[model samples]
Target: MKLGILGGTFNPVHTAHLRIAEEVRERCGLDRILFVPAATPPHKELAGAIPFADRYAMVAAAIADNPDFVATDLENRRAGKSYSVHTLELLHEEYPQDTFYFIIGMDSYRSLGIWKDFPRLFELANLVVAARPGIPCKDPLALLPVVIRDQFCYHESAHMLRHRSGNIVVFFEETYLDISSTQIRRLVSEGRSIRYLLPTAVEHYIYRHGLYHNDERF
Candidate 1:
């Protein structure tokens, strides 16, 4: 089985998140894409102190229509900070026979050097870095950490990097939706319409739970 893992805060899963998963699934021939909402993200704080259950529920609602997409509480179940390396390690142990593809946006890929055990990520799964709006990743290899750059051989034709661990890093250009979680939250806080920005279920969930309305940061 070919599984793709997309982990995020998902304060409220938006359409762009779903679209990215769909695009990567189709382009990479993935059987399923697991949406793992972080209970406590390691990098940044959750905007409104929204509970993990709410975030996870929104993710479930957003991807409910897609049979190929799944929502998992893998990060929620684990203790401490939600680190990508630990998540990948757990998944590898659980599905030893399956090939894993860790999906990430270009923005996140650029900051991967600071992630815990980031270099080991290539050993665990193939990376599919999808392009995001306003983030120009003209030379993906140049963005990689200098220490590990020599371990990968770039394939110009395929826009991929072959790591010594046998896993590959693919740069995928998917449909860019300018929508962002921050934008959605700001709109909701300002009492503006958040419709069409995300799945109807997710939009409704945010309102039903009264999230982001009191968030002063937005």
Candidate 2:
């Protein structure tokens, strides 16, 4: 089985998040995509960040209609800070026969070196670096160590990822989404409507919970 992992804070899952997963599934020929919400993101930890359960619940609601998209609380359920390498290791052990693909943005790809146990992560799963608008694939050498830079596979779109490596390769998704959870949070905090920015269910959930309002970080 081919499984794609789309890990994020998902403080509130949006249409773009669902769209990216769908595109990746179709483009990468993935049997299913898992949305893993981070419990404690190492890089971006904000004060008054929404609780993990609320974020998980919102994600579950956003992707419930898509059979190919599923939600996982691995980070939330696990102890300690959430790290990609640890999650990938656990996933590989649990599904030895399955091939795992780690989906991430081009910007995130540029910062892979600073990630914890990044080298081990590459060995466990193929890294699918999704391109972003205005962000060119700069020198991987400058961004990452020589050993770590060797693990990347670039793809122009989700379509290209589907036909990769005779079923053994890291896929690159070229198409980029303009949406961001951080932007959504800012809009909400500014008393602006995010109707089109996110899934209807997610927007409703945010409003119902009154999140981002009291969140000073926003």
Candidate 3:
């Protein structure tokens, strides 16, 4: 089975998140897309101190109607910070026969160098870097971390890079929905309409729980 892993803080999973997962799943021929909400993201802080359970519930509700989409609490089960490398390693161990495609945005791809055990990520799974609005990654090779740059060879025709580990890194240009969790949260806090920005189920869940209602920052 080919699984696409989409990891995020998910403070509240928005429409773009679901669209990206679906786009990547179709583009990469993935059997399922795992929505792994980070328990404690290492890179940045959550917009508000929303509990992981609430975030996970929102993800579950957002993807409920889609049979191909699944919400997993793998990161939450782990003790420490939710690191992509660690999550990938765990996925490999648990599903040895399955192939994994680590789905990330172009912005994350540009900042890959700072991630823990980032080079090992190629060894664990193929990378699918989805293009984001305002983030241009025209030359994917040039953005690679210098230390591991030589480990991959670019195939211009295919627009992908093949790592020595046999895992490939591909760039994808999917339908761009400029909606963001930060924007949703901000809108909710100001008592504005958050309709259509996310799933109706998720919107209802957020309002029921009063999430982001008092947040001062976006």
Candidate 4:
């Protein structure tokens, strides 16, 4: 089976997160899409980050109705700071027969080189980069640094980069809702309506836990 991995902080999983996964699965011909919430993200600010348990719960609640979607605790099951490369490596080892696709946004694609063991990540799975508003949707190879770009070659027929190591970067154009976890958190803090931004179950979960209340970074 082809697996699509969509990893994120998911401080609160929102509609866009679900939509992107759905689109990517359909476009990439993936049999399953796993939403892996990071236990401790390495690059982003975690000042007001929610606890791992709460974040994981929200992901589970958001994707509950979709049979094809799964909320995984892969990162939460591990110790220490989370790194994508390591996660992908373990996944490849465990599911040797599966073709894995690591999903990311265009913004993440631009900073791919700086990631820990980034070259090895490409070797483990194909990258499915979804375009978001304000982030350009272009040849992903061009966005990589010169050194990283040297490893990829655009296959005009495939419309994806065929890496020297047999890895491929699939640049997928998708219709994404302009919603963010940051914006939802800010609204909740301001006592504003967060309707339609995320699943109703997730909204209720946030309120019950008093999450992002005033954005105090507690």
* Model 4 lDDT on a 0 to 1 scale: 0.86
Show where candidate 4 strays beyond 4 Å: 133-139
For model 3, how does the per-residue alpha-carbon lDDT over 119-178 read when each residue is reduced to its tens digit? 999999999999865655668899999999999999988989999999999997879998
Window of ten residues with lowest summed lDDT in model 3: 131-140
Compared to the true structure, candidate 3 yields what TM-score?
Answer: 0.97
Residues 40-60, candidate 4, lDDT per residue (tens digit)?
999987748678999999999
Best by TM-score: 3
In terms of TM-score, how similar is model 4 to the real structure? 0.93
Model 3 pairs in collision: none
- Give per-residue lDDT, candidate 4, residue 192: 91
Give me the runs in candidate 1 sitting further than 4 Å from their true place: 133-138
Q: Looking at candidate 2, what is the lDDT of residue 16?
A: 79
RMSD of 1: 1.4
Compare candidates 1 and 2 on TM-score and give the better one: 1
> Which candidate's lDDT is highest?
3
103-213 per-residue lDDT for model 1 (tens digits): 998878989999999999999999999985555566778899999999999888888899999999998677998888999999999999999999999989988989999
The order by descending lDDT is: 3, 1, 4, 2
Can you rank all candidates by TM-score, best first?
3, 1, 4, 2
